[model samples]
Target: MTTESLAEPTMRVRPGWTVAVVLANVGVFAAWFGPIQVLLAKQSEALAPDNKEFVFGLVTGIGAAVSVVAAPIWGAVSDRTTSRFGRRMPWTLGGALGAAAGLLVLSGAQGVALMLVGWCLVQLFGNAVLAAQTATVPDRVPVEQRGVVGGWVAVAQVPGALVGTALATVFGGIAVGYIACAIFVVLSVLPYVARAQDARLVVAPAFVLRDFLRGFWISPRRYPDFGWAWLTRFLFNVGNSIGLLYLFYYLQDEVGVPDAGTSVLVLTAIYSVCTLVTAIAFGAWSDRLGRRKIFVVASGLVMAVAAVVLAFWPTWPGAVLGAIVLGIGFGVYLSVDFALITEVLPNAVDRAKDLGVINIANSLPQVIAPVIAAPIVKHLGGYPVLYLLSAVITALAGVLVGKVRSVK
Candidate 1:
C-alpha cells in the first residue's frame, strides 16, 4: 500500500493486520512495562536499600522525560520519511532492536547511573516503535472498525505487562530477568515487522525549519476536541500512574504480602483476566452503538471507584477487588478513547505526529507521577491519601470527557 491510498482509510483492515498490530503492541509494552513493574524496583533496592523509592522514582522520571521528547520527534521524522521499505517499518524494527540493546545495558548495570542510561535508551526507542505503530491504525483501519480494533490493540497491554512481570519473577536473578525480557522484546516484535503492509511514502516532505517546528504545536483553541481529548487522557493517566507506580512498595510496606514479587504477579493476573473480558466486548459494543463519549466517561468514573476501594481497604482481598474494578474500567477507557482520539485528529498527513503529541498524555504521567507521588507517599497521609487523590483526578477526567464535542 502507498500513502496516497490511505488519505482516509475506508476499508476494513484484515484480521491478520489486526493480529500483527496487537502482537507488536504487546512486544513494545512488554519491553517498556517489565522494568516499570518489576526489575527497576529490584535494581533500585539492590543499589540503595535505604532510599530505594527515591532511586526508582528518579530513574523512571528521567526515562519518561526522554520519552516525552523522543515520541513526537520520531513521529515527525517518520511522517517525512520516504523509505521504499515503508515509513513506519524501518523505525519499528530499529526501535525494537535499540530497546533490546537498552535492556542488555540494564542487565549489566551495577550502579544507578548506568541503570538510568539504560532506561532512558529504552524509553527513547520504545516510543519510536509506539508512535509508528499507533499511526498505522488511522492509516489502514476504517473509522467504523476502529473501536473493535482499538480494543484489541489496547488490551495487548494487559498481556504485555503480565508476560513481562512473569518473566521478571520467573527468572529470579536481576540480570537473568533483564536478559529474558530483552529476548522477548526482540522475538515478539519480529512477526509484526515482517508482516506489516505499511503505507510507503514515495516522496519526502520539504523541511522548512520554521514550519517544521511550528507543526508540533496543534493549537488547543483551534482544535478544541483534540485539546479536551488530550486533557482527559492526561488526567486519566495521572490517576492510573499514581495508583500503579508504587504498587510494589504498597504490597511490601502496607499489605505485608509474603513475596511481594509473586503477589504483584497474582494481582496482575486478576487484572488481566478482567481487562481481557471487557476490552474487546465493550469496544465492539461501542462500534455497534456508534458511540464513544458515554463509554469513556463511564469507564473513568469506574476507575475512580476502583481507586476509592484501594484507599479505603488495604487488605489482600481489597487489592484483588481493586484490580478487578480497575481492569474493567481501564479496558473500556483505553479501547473507546483510542478510537475517539483518532476521529478528532486535525490532519490526515500528521496522524503520527498528532498521536505522538497525544501520547505525551501517556508518558508525561510517568514523569509527573513519581514527582508528586514520592512526596505524598512519604509525608502526606501515605498510600490512602495517595489513592484518594487518584480517585478524585480520575473522576474529573470522566466529567471532562464531555467537553469533546467532535466525538459522541
Candidate 2:
C-alpha cells in the first residue's frame, strides 16, 4: 500500500475508453457553454438584460435540477442496455446526440422559459455521458490504475471549461457560443467511443430497479468505507462548487472588473492555463504516489486557504493568487478523487450502480451549494462572508475524507 508500490499501477493505468468519454464532454461543454450568441441583439439583451439576473439564476437552477433525475435514470438505462458497442458506448453515443440536439434547441430559444427548457434538456441528456463513463473506471480499470485515469478525466476539464468559457465570452453572441459547445462535446467524446474496449461482464450485476435502489443502502452499511467515501465526495464537491461557481462574480464585484469581453477572456485564459497544468501533473503524481486521500485533503485545505485570502483581501492581485490556489486544489481533487472512490466499493459486482450512487455525490452537492451560498451571501452581506463560509466547509470536507482508513 505504500506510495512507491501504488504508483506503478496507478500510473500504468491506461485510460482506455474512459478518457475518450471525458473528451466528448469537453467538446459538448465548449459548444453549449461557450459564447454562442454574439450576433443576435435580442438574445444578448435577454440573457444579459438590465433586470433579469433572477431569470438567469432560475434558468441555471433549472438546468442543475434537471440533472438530478437525469443522472440516475441514465445510469439505470446504461445498466439495462446490453448492446454490441457495449452498454457504456450506446449511452455515450446517445448522450452525445442528445447533447447536440439540446444545444441546437438552446441556440433557437427565444424567451426565459425556452432557454430554461433547452438548458434543462442539455443538462439532462447531455450529462447521461457521465452515468455511462464513470462506471467504466471501476468496471474495467484495475483499482490501482483508477487514479491516473481519474487524473486524465480531471485535466480534461481545463479545455472543457476554459475553452468554452473563452468562446462564449469572446464571441459575445448567443447562438455561436452554444453551437460551438455542441461541436466541442461531440469531438471530445469520439475517441472514447472508438478506442475503449467494452468492459467484459464483470461484477456489475444486470439491472433490476428494485434491487438497485435497495443496493444503495445495502452497500454503504455493509462497506464502511463506501459510506465515508460518498460523504467525502459530496462535501468536497460542495466546497469546491462554492469557489468555482462564484469565482467570476467575485472578480466582477471585488476587483470592480467590468464584465467586458476583454476582461472575461483574460480571466479564462489565466485560470484555465494555471489549472490545467497543475491538475494533470498532480493527478499523475497522486497515482504514482499511491495516495489519493492526502491529495484530497490537500485540495480541500488549499481551497479553504484560498477562500480566506479572497474573503479579506478582495484585490485583483489577491484574486489572482486565490485563483491559482483554487485551480491547483480543484484540479488535483477532480483528477484523483474518483480513484479513491473506486478503491472502496463493497464489491466489484455492483460497480456501476454503486458508482452511480457516488456520482450523485458529485451532482447533489452542486444542487445544495448554490441554494445555501446565494442565501448566505445575501443575508451575511457580501462575497467575503461567502468565501469565509466556503473555507469552513472545505476544511470540514477534508476532515471527513480522513474518515476513510479502509480505502488504503
Instruction: List candidate 1 stretches off by more than 4 Å.
Output: 1-6
lDDT of 1: 0.90
lDDT at residue 315 of model 2 (Cα atoms): 82
Per-candidate TM-scores read 0.98, 0.86
Which residue runs does candidate 2 get wrong by more than 4 Å? 1-19, 28-51, 200-209, 216-219, 260-262
* Root-mean-square deviation of Cα positions for candidate 1 versus the true structure, in angstroms: 1.1
lDDT of 1 by residue, 294-363 (tens): 9999998999999999999999999999999999998899889999999999988888889999999999
- Residue 350 lDDT, candidate 2, scale 0-100: 48
lDDT for each candidate structure: 0.90, 0.67
lDDT of 2 by residue, 164-216 (tens): 77656656566777776677677767898888666433333455778766655
